[model samples]
Target: MKTAVILLPGLNRDRDMIAAITHISGEPPVTVWQTDTTIPDVDLIIVPGGFSYGDYLRCGAIAARMPFMKALKEKAAQGVKVIGVCNGFQILLEAGLLPGALMRNASLKFVCREVELEVSNASTAFTSGYSQGQIIRCPVAHHDGNYFVDDATLKTLQDDNRIAFRYANGTNPNGSIDNIAGILNAEGNVLGMMPHPENLIEHAHGGVDGRALFESALGLVAA
Candidate 1:
């Protein structure tokens, strides 16, 4: 399956994401610059993690206005699959493709370490390879990964099974409400998470738990 990865000006993880994709799918994902106004036809699109526009104004705020994001928004409306990791998740929130905002760590510090994430919803294309409530190890490195939303919206997300992942073992490193580590759109076509699955694709890096995410997407595209 063809996959496209959007690269923002300050993106740092595009190549890592590409490596993970190629490792699993045996094909290099196309890299699309943020300034590009068009998106190529692909089964999946990934907004890789990075400090887009140097995190000016706010994380992902500036990059959200890029031309390519407009095209991404349009594609999302047509049911195309999209995944956003770390800063990419922040961009998705800024772009209004997903709800809630990422705020500074509750402790007001940057956090970098392996974090345990519980798969809360495995029915989505992104998490289908994992079992619900299964715990996976992944790396999270961010100063503003705390996710916040109004209580009502949180309730809606909980009721609809949109809360796809949460910090496992009561480890809320960034003070995210209810330990939320990731979420999926109501339609389950878009997924945004704070952890870096790409960083965990190789056992040499730590573990291979992240391979499930890519495999799940490949399954969707193949289907």
Candidate 2:
């Protein structure tokens, strides 16, 4: 499957994301710059983590307004799969491509560590490689990973099984609402998550627990 990675100033994780995708799919992804007004045809588009625009305006607030994001929104509307990790997740929410918002960590500090995540909804293209309720290890590094949503929207997400990954095993690093580590859009083609799955997809990262996500997104296995 062809993939693309979004690049912006201050984003430091694009290389890791590109490496993961290339290693898993045996193909390097096209890199899209923030100033670019269009994105090429691709099966998956990833917004990797880092402090975009130096996180000057509430994490991804500034990056969300970039020209590239407009193209991303259009691709999302067309059902192209999109995954945004860490700051990228914040950008997606800021761009209105996904629901809810991510706020500062409950402890009001930066957090970096491994956390367990449960596969809350394994039916989506992003989670089909795992079984519902299955737990996996992933790394997270962010200062504003706390996720929140209103009661009504939370209920809707629950009803629709859109919650993809939840912090499991008492490892709620940022105190996100309902332990939400990841979620899917209404169409299930877009995913926004705080954890850095790209950092954990290889054995050199100590484990390959995060490989299934890319595998699923690329349709490498039968769902």
Candidate 3:
């Protein structure tokens, strides 16, 4: 399976994301620039964490308006599996690929720590390797992670079983509504999450809980 990661100007975690994906998938993913007019057609595309364009004018705002969005949106509409982590999640919301917004943390500070996330819906392509209700450790490093959606929209997300992960242990690090850590789009081909699963895919990182995400995506395409 082919995977690609987009690199945006001023993004700090592109290299880290590259290393993690290489380690987990045994192949380095292709890197594309945010300014590009087109993105490569790949089985999986990841928009990794870190401040894009220094997060100027709101998180993910500048990068969202880049010329590449049209092609990226087209592929997503065609059922390409796309996953966004941290700032990437913010971009997806800003680009209108996903609903809702990520607001500042209730604590109003950048939080960096390993947080527990329960796999709320293991049926999607992104979480198929995870068991339902399984708690996994993943690193969350972000200043804006409080997910916000209207009550009616939240209920629709719940009714459709689109909630992918929720903070475990009653630990609401960002005060996200319903403690949601991740969600899937209506078509289930896209996933957006605050925690960086790519951060914990290596043995030296103190856990391999994130490997399942890569495995599930690759396996599905292989099948």
- For candidate 3, write residues 1-223 as lDDT tens digits: 7888988887777788888778767899998887787778789888888999888888999988998777788889999998889999999989988889999999999999989999999888988899999999998999999999999999999999999999999777899999999998999998999999887887888898888888887774233
TM-score of each: 0.97, 0.99, 0.96
| Candidate 2: residue pairs that collide | none
Segments in model 3 whose C-alpha atoms lie over 4 Å from true places:
220-223
Model 1 regions lying over 4 Å from their true place: 220-223
Which run of 10 residues does model 2 get worst, by summed lDDT? 214-223
Candidate 2 per-residue lDDT, tens place, 49-94, comes to 9999999968899999999988999999999999999999999999
Please report the TM-score between candidate 1 and the true structure.
0.97
What C-alpha lDDT, on a 0 to 100 scale, does residue 102 get in candidate 2? Answer: 96
lDDT of 3: 0.88
Compared with the true structure, all predictions reach lDDT values of 0.91, 0.94, 0.88
Error of 1 at 20 (Å): 0.5
- Of 1 and 3, the candidate ahead on TM-score is 1
lDDT of 1 by residue, 100-209 (tens): 99999998989999989999998888988899899999888999999999999999999999998999997778999989999988888999999999998787886899
Give residue 89's error in model 2 in angstroms: 0.4
